[model samples]
Target: MVNNKTCPGCGVMLPNKNLEFSDQYNASGECIQLYHELSANFIMSPDVTFRTQHAVDAYGAQHSGNRVKNIRTAFSLIGLYLAVEREYTGRQVQHAHMELAKRNIKWSSFILPIRPYALSVADVLNIVEVKRNEMLMEWSKNVWDTWENYHEWTRNICKSYLKHF
Candidate 1:
């Protein structure tokens, strides 16, 4: 029950699959580790969330890159979220002004810089938030103006088809 928490819908190990049916064991342990961290702490715990080299070797080399990419995506999102908090919340979350030094960006370390940037994480966060808000607003407006009037579109399509017929 503690270590082997399988999906409610399936009876396989949480991280292992019963390959006869793909959906039979879909809730992965690695996935749940990240999910619980985000749900409980609202922050990414990079150390705890990914597969080891042994696990990757045991599973398949083909999936190794995907596992690392997923871990990196979590880290990037946390960085972006911290930047957003710095933009709007200001000292509310720890590491608000923090950013990766140019050399350290390639290493993906969480170390505070020896000489931090004047440009600041908050500026990056604010830009990200603004861009995200702009895209979301545009998408919502497009959906409202286009897809929400699906009945009218269908009617027009039918009318145009009848005219051709």
Candidate 2:
């Protein structure tokens, strides 16, 4: 029997259902997972000042989607070196998060999804840290190299970001 249940993630009616016998059903069998499209038109506004630490935090919370553009604008007028380094630093964090998605899986420790997309930069960093630690614990010798790479990637990003200040 087909349940025709609604998928929560995609909000679509799917073909998930029961197989004969004991009427056991799989709700997620026909789920349509939705990909989060990046925020649109993030750089339309004027450049925000990153002079103060508060401004930096606010920018991360409010304009994380358009980080590169804003950083370029704000720093081009104030400090070009900072602009370039920030872009480099931000891009690295973004890349590491993307790579984390493909390798994320949990059985023994059951780590949840990091959900790096569609979130503020601070939230993304926080969630990714949690997931990274979980992955570190679960990683065996076979996957140790990949895990180390991710760790080093984030560490370097932090170093680059700090260089801006």
Candidate 3:
């Protein structure tokens, strides 16, 4: 008594009567569950920017003001450091920068990506801080001796960067 139906989990056509006995019949599968949740939330969200016409007409809003100034400054500094570091290490920094620019990722989207590189510098800093804190906490037990050595290596890398700067 198998009825034709769709296996919502993997989007495969199956028997409707077998769906109850199948282990992969979920409509909201794990593959797209998170994306669906995010899309739904975004659809119901309101636009609150003061610069928008709706906000201005409703509440006489003022300028929204610049938000990414500090972040931009930090990114510039980081980019300069990276450039200097690459030159000091005999790497083709200009070529890399040009390639990135060719991909339409200049100063604007260089620090951002669609997925993997989308993380901000602040996020990297937070991760570094967490590792440092963990190392410090375990220093008394000598558990982070190797970690401390790794920090020294990173410091040397930065020193080489500063040399070219």
Candidate 4:
């Protein structure tokens, strides 16, 4: 019988081959480990323009729930919004985060959908190497779409804080 562990947060099932993350996200250690491997692929790429920065935000937001800190969840949602909606590069998203931080505005956590995401790190981890970036973006979009309930609030935060974005 194959042993598998499912992430309590994202519902990603993987062979029980890694330690679990102990963070507030309550992510399956295997899932977070897989995400690290996928992230390293983008971070180590020769292409400087790939949207690597968005990966953290996308993953975090997709995995967020009541147990996750409100501020952290807010940041993740905002970052995904800028990446998918504003077409902001990872670097631009970083700057937008910085701008929002300067305002010290309180971020309210929304009630996210209870549905498990259609795609997770596991989906893109095994794709053709050349198509990884494209797949990553698609993954990000899918995750962002799952959080559709907060799109309007996300946009408002950007408009209020990231004036130049």
**How well is each residue in 103-153 modelled by candidate 1, as lDDT tens digits?**
133323221113211321112223453363333223222222222223343
Please report, as a residue range, the 10-residue window in candidate 2 with the lowest summed lDDT.
32-41
Better of 3 and 4 by TM-score: 4
For residues 28-78, write the lDDT of model 4, one tens digit per residue: 888888888988888888655557677788778877774788877888889
Each prediction's TM-score against the native?
0.18, 0.18, 0.17, 0.91
lDDT, candidate 3, residue 36? 36
Model 2 scores what on Cα lDDT? 0.27
Tens digits of lDDT, candidate 2, 7-100: 3211235455542211111112232111111111122323243222222222222221211243322221122122222432323433433443
For the record, the alpha-carbon RMSD of candidate 2 to the native fold, in angstroms, is 16.8
Best prediction by lDDT: 4
- Which has the greatest TM-score? 4
Worst 10 residues of 4 by lDDT: 17-26
In candidate 1, how many Å is residue 36 off?
2.8
Clash-forming residue pairs, model 3: 3-16
Off by over 4 Å in 3: 1-75, 88-91, 105-165
Go through the candidates in order and give the clash count of each. 0, 0, 1, 1
Provide the lDDT at 86 for model 4. 77
- Report the poorest 10 consecutive residues by lDDT, candidate 3: 56-65
Stretches of candidate 2 exceeding 4 Å from the true structure: 1-3, 19-27, 32-94, 98-165
